[model samples]
Target: MALKPKDIALRAASALVLAPAAVLAIWAGGFWFTGLIVLGGIMLALEWARMSEPQDWRAVGMAVAAGVIAPVIAAHIGQMSLAFVLLVFGAAIAGLVSNRRGGEGLDGAYGVLYLGWPCILLVWMRDLNADQGLYWTVLVFAVAWAADILAYLVGSAVGGPKLWPRFSPNKTWSGFIGGLLAGMIAGGVMAAWLDMGALTAFWGAVLGLLAALATMGGDLWESALKRRFGVKDAGNLIPGHGGLLDRVDGLMFAVIVVAIGRLIVLMIGGNA
Candidate 1:
């Protein structure tokens, strides 16, 4: 399939707006950064709830509340474990509320956890250190961005078998391989730019591959969810992106992967 001119223009225009704002917020790496994560989480929750249980305002409310609460817990209390516990509790509440309101309880719970954890982890990643915070956050974004863009381009140019027809028919194996390569290159470049050394650059490339795979999974998951809900797009909130959730779905998953990897390394090094 060929890429549409209008789609390209819209994507470019949207990138023009979103890219600068995201880079600026990440570079700041403080309340500004946290605020952006919070906003993204809330938007994701809203989109999820609206898509999964369209008539259930209670589900939306619960998810959004959980989204807001989780990040606050992470940023203010700085207790990740406690924040996760709170998120679980919130999900339980959301599930119960949805059930009572004649909706799917599991969907409510899923929505909260799906959007909440990533937002908290993103803040946690940025708060790791004053010097390394920006580098780490930007590195993850670079991987996701590079993968998404390259995948789109390659898939359109090298049309072939779908990667997963059941979930995302548009994605192709060619796109997947191309995206992984682009992600690795982007990750290595970012690591070098940060002066993190060759070893770190190699690991960054590896992480980029892992992150790109995770991102593809994330995108597929959302596509499946939308299909389940019989929706074309999550929302029309963003000009080219469809919704904030649409834009960050892959990022949310990639952030968790990168954060977990970082945490494991920190623990092994006795810094966690």
Candidate 2:
């Protein structure tokens, strides 16, 4: 379905306003912003959990555990080792506790990883470096947005072969390629503008492509969870954006991936 001109305008306008607001919030919002994200994670996690364990209170407990603890864990951004331990142990304990909920075992296991793990990564990425912290955050999301937005617009305009029929039937190979190119172009341009190192620029292109795919995986992953749960969307948070999960799906995957990459770079002493 085509996005009406008015819809496009509204989306752009909201994005224009909200994007800067979001940045500023992240910039100054500090740990509370991390807490706010954890709140969103809880909502999304609970929604996913309720799918297979509709009658379970343990699932709710797991969401609560995640909401409270994930932020505490996230607050240890510079302390990667401690944060990583918390995430792993938290997911494990949450998963074990959730098993009493019956068919929700797999659901709980995945939900914790889906909602909580990425949050850890996001915080870690935030504390990666001094000079380019905000720049990197903006680039990661910007590239992901380029991939998603372009794919939707171009795919709707020029439909083609399905990219993944089982998970996302409407996704097209052509659309995927278009999104990749658009993201690469955005990443490349941003890298040039930012005067990032050669390796950083290369990482931007490589990570941009990988993050796009991961972001798509996130969308399909959430869609699968929702389908099993017999829900339309995770929540009605955004007017046209479906829900918090729908909005942050890309971020959920991309952030962790960014975290891992940054961690590796740090382990080896990154250039900048």
Candidate 3:
């Protein structure tokens, strides 16, 4: 179904406000960026808990909150390895608490990883290369945002066969293609702007394509979660977007892809 003009306006307005703030945080790259990640992670945890176990939402939320916060703090302090370990430990704690309280232990555990890993990775990635970290972070955001915006616009205008009727009935093949192209173009442009070599630009485009695929996967996964919970939106935190989780779902996955890709390049003695 096409969004009403009012809905579109709301989305645009929200993006106008949020995008700049996010970009500014990314540029700041220290306490500001870490703070944003922490806040978003906490909100996501609460939302997940609310959806998964409304009756025991507080307990689950607190558990997930601890899980997300500890790792974020660790990552911010340059303890990447400790951050990963803390994330696992936090998830385990959350799971145990949920199981004892008669909630789904696996759901609670998954929530920590789902909402927390990206936060940790984002911080780690930002600190990976002091010189290029800003550019890389901005590139990830640009690709994800461009892909999402293009997908929505193209999908609504050129509605055709549904991409996945089960998970996301409203998504179309046209939208997916549009988003993919947008991601590639955005990544390439960012690389070129950074004055990287042509080969780097080509690799950037490839990364964008991978991120786009991951973005779609993330969106579909979130849709499946909502479907299982029988909710239309995660929460009404934003004017147009459903919640913090809804807004950052695709970006979260894209971050994971980009971070892993960077790590692989580093391990192989290649410049990322």
Candidate lDDT values, in order: 0.79, 0.65, 0.87
Best by TM-score: 3
* Top lDDT hit: 3
lDDT of 2 by residue, 43-66 (tens): 666655555466785455565356
Candidates 2 and 3, the one with greater lDDT: 3
| Model with the higher TM-score, candidate 2 or 3 | 3
Q: Model 2 — which ten-residue stretch has the worst lDDT?
A: 67-76
A best-first ranking of the candidates according to their TM-score comes to 3, 1, 2
Encode model 1's per-residue lDDT on 119-196: one tens digit a residue. 778788788777666777888899999888888888888889899998788889998888889888887778777843
Candidate 3 segments exceeding 4 Å error = 195-199, 268-272
CA shift of 237, model 3, Å? 0.2
lDDT of 1 at 154: 89
* Model 3 Cα lDDT, one tens digit per residue, 1-272: 56467877889999999989888889989899999998888899999999988879999999999999999999989898899999999999999988988999998999999998889988887876775677778878988988888898889888889999997899999999999999999887787777432327888899888898888788889999999988888888998898888898999999998887667667665554
Model 1 sits at a Cα RMSD from the real structure of 2.0
